[model samples]
Target: MYRVWNFINNYSLLLVAGALIALIWANFDTHAYHHFVEYPLWFNDWIGGDFTRWANNYGEGFEKFEVGDVTKVLSVHYLVNDILMAFFFAIAAKEVWEAVILKEGSLRGKKAATPLIATLGGMLGPIAIYVGLAALMGSATFDAISRGWAIPSATDIAFAYLVGRVVFGAGHPAVRFLLLLAIADDAAGLIILAIFYPSGDLAPAWLLVSLGSAVGVFVLFNWLPRMMDRGDQLRPMSSWVRKYLSFWPYLLAGCASWFGFQEAGLHPALGLLPIVPTIPHADRAFGIFSEAEQYLTDLLNQIEHMLKHPVEVVLFFFGLLNAGVEFSSIGTPTWLVLAGLMIGKPLGVTIFGWIAARPLGLGLPSGMRALDLVVVGCVAAIGFTVSLFIASVAFDGNVVLNGIHVQDAAKMGALFSFAAAAVSIVVGKLLRVEKQHG
Candidate 1:
């Protein structure tokens, strides 16, 4: 019973279950799925009022100010994709910051160069393959589908980590390498999202305001601690006061940044990212779950621990919201994404890794062979959560582009990551990459 509970609690399992439920539910009753997602939630008598009219009236203040005017007509889907997923991206940002900046981390200094290069290949390869295929179809199709070039560029860290554990065991060097690559991939994906995907005309003033808020939080959280250490009399406070009060600035700044991004026509999931590296973090010497006193001092670590389970739940809902697609809706863009992820990912990883190791003089980690790189590449092909998010952004509601059809197809392609997982398992078994038990 305990084992079953643990298995169910596992992150990968939870994500898989959520995706499975969505797939089944969507396929079983497509109408029900659509209706459930589109069900309106608002606080007013005008439940099904014209949205554009409401927006215009609210903006111009012609109608009386009321919180009830705000409505989420497609409540469930948007809530999960737009709001809940922000925390997921925040967590990813935190992980990337820790890997690159922490002293005892794997990706710090010269050691990071190899994995960073590999990540570049991992990104470029998919774009090349996807764009090349799209180009062959015709100029119009190519231009439209090219927006999703980054869709296959992400490797879901949890899924890839699980597959790595099974293939290379718990303590293998390959696992660490894969982890670093995934982190770098995430960093790249975030950049792509910010640069390529904007909701409306970019508002520089709002972006500046967001940056200012992040800076303010950094000053409060980081500078305040330094001041206390210097024995500044004005900054004197009890330990408990300092510990608890420090969290508020982060919350405030995060809210400001989210709003700012919304106003700036950018994806708000990236709002907390610039703030993560600024938050105080403990050295890696204090193990991830350590109860050591220093662990309590690290606000970023504390926030991450606090949000872990919540983020997991959000990811489950994320899968449920985004993974639903009809088989009949799939087309060329879907096949292109599948090919990009499944074939291009592994090929790019292997080829680029060789370039880095051989000519670039960055040697492979100890106990890792060339063929092991191939297996790791296969694992890297498992792109799910972030891929789907990119898909949503890429095809969202542009009428001239057959946006609805393309969006459904892109989503189907993202869900097809299960095929990549199966391929990884097969490759791992063929290579005899088994867990070593003492």
Candidate 2:
């Protein structure tokens, strides 16, 4: 029991494991598991699994945020992405800036395949999965949400790190590269989201305004140090001007940028493109303000960290909450989606990686084999967060209202994908372990 606790805690893999457990409990009833499973978390009739019921309840119960005739209660999904996921993107931006741009050799330091190859592999994985699913399902259902192309593009660093720790022990460099690759891949995913997932209703006027705001933010970031230097030379009546002007105004402006992009109907996550530049460096000394501004920066950092995980957690729960697959519902389509993730993902990612590597003359990392590539590909298929978000945006609940429920169908496909990936990892590990012994 202690060992199990340790495994869950150390790996951070508990999120996924817990999600799978919740999904199974929701869908199935073992006496013990059912007794242990908590229902309160998912008990809201107004917001539970039934979309039509939730919609009906909203019309009857509330009267707020009425846009024309579309008066519905706020979607948790919308709240999570628009408000919560903006912070997720902010944190991700910080990490990517640190890893790829600021940190030395963080991404470029590796002797293995170029950052370009890994980034491409990250992209090609999902596209392959989608195309294969479309072909197998005899419909373009998967392609409807081109927004979801990035869903399979990002790997969960925590899960990948846990696997690394378990198989290779702590402080392994290979794991570090794997984590870095995942981070770069996530940044790439963010770029794709900003570019692809717009609602297609363009106000060229607002887009120009957003672009201007972005330019202003960039100019502010560049001009800040010069402004501070000038302020120092002027030796203001109140020294606080340097700090207050430097910190709080920028923070407010940065937050306003979040509001701006959100209003522009782009994914709010794109807001980070402007604000990240405005944040003061931790290493920089802000000598003027009353230490409050410094504290605020720290606070912002902490908030940023906390916000990053919830978007992920919400998706994890949504996956679990909806993963309640009726075993009786199992059929050819089920198997096809399952096979797409299990067989299609690794196959696509590895082949793409291999193609990107050989003739391009980008060699694989030392001690990294085709099998390791396969396992990495499997890990890539664990698309809980982005996949669901994409499904919501792409289908806009149209698929759910249509005969097939969108959330349920996505969860089913994701669960099968996750299961296949998990099995692949376990098998890959066992094979590696056996080879070491032999």
Candidate 3:
């Protein structure tokens, strides 16, 4: 049982399995796959009813559900991407906060300056290439396709980190650099999703309320620990109250913020981000999962540990729901995504790293050469999971605007990350990256 759990816990393996199952299952029985994902579990009458009739009777602003309508049925895709994926983003945001803001993190000072700059280049490079391709294509659908520019910008950290370890061996400085770069990419992607992918008119009041809720959680997290340590009795609670109840504030804050973002017309995946930095975290000096470190009972770490396996399960459903696009639908947008990830990823990372190292006066870590950085950039092109998520956001149910059927095209392109991985392996071999033998 222990060994089985450990094997399933291998993120790279699980992600790959989920993706392969989606691809193969979709191709084999497209109708069955679609039927499974689109099957409604609840609120069938309201959702399946005529939109025109509802809008005419209820008028504008009526589409937004009231508290009573909270139980509306949603498809498998909606549940996975909108609700379950919030936790995934929460974990990613937690890692980003630890790396960038924590005193002992890699980006704390000048030590991480080069990789930070490289991360920026990595993000912008893909966007530039993607948008540039869209412009050059001069197709009528360019505007619709370009909305997905941020899709290829993300670096699937789990895939990149795992492949880097295998290709470059453990303990390599380049692997560390890629990890930081990928974390930064996640931060950038989250910001883009919040700013660019709003579903309705912006509601500033709700957004403010959401931020206020996060602030309240932050205050509670900081104050509760100290109050407990001092043994100050509040409502006759004991020390165990502080130990077990510390996580509730985060949960409440997350829920409140999710509602706020939903009301504010923004993607709710970002709801937990504002609170992550405020949550108490242990000093990850030895790394997040180091068994050697003593247990510190950090709130964020505890949350992450509890949620890891569940998030993996969510990722599997995410793949099953979104990755089953028809191969015949592959088109220009699909090619654009593939090219951006495969060609632009390496080009951007290497060029940006050179600029940072030479003109920006940031030095690369010892034993890490410029060519090695290029290889690392190639590995960074594996933007599978998040790319798919963004594709769904960019094109699904949005046919009136894009006019071009981009959901399948974009998803097909996301699956091309497998090809990108193959390219990375070839590039690594050509660059003579040493392979570790157990």
TM-score of each: 0.86, 0.69, 0.86
Better of 2 and 3 by lDDT: 3
Clashes of each: 0, 1, 1
Model 3 regions more than 4 Å off: 1-9, 44-73, 224-240, 288-294, 398-404, 435-438
- Pairs in steric clash, model 3: 42-73
Tens digits of per-residue lDDT, candidate 1, 245-336, equal 76777777887887788678788777777777777777762322223422455677778767767877887887777777777767877888
- Residue lDDT tens for model 3, 1-438: 001123123666667677788888878987677667655444533322223333332333445544244434455655677778899899788777877766888667887888888888888888888999898977666766878888888888778876777677766778778877887888888988899887456886889878898888766666565555675555333345446776787788888888788678788767777777777777763443344233557777777768878888888788777887777777888888888888888888999888888888888887687888888889999888889888887874434323445878887888887676677788888988865432
lDDT of every model, 2 decimals: 0.73, 0.50, 0.74
Model 3 quality (TM-score)? 0.86
183-284, model 2: which lDDT tens digit per residue? 667777677676777643444355555556556654665444446567477645224533565445545655667556655667765665666754544433
Candidate rank order under lDDT: 3, 1, 2
Error of 1 at 43 (Å): 8.0
Better of 1 and 3 by lDDT: 3
Give the winner by lDDT: 3
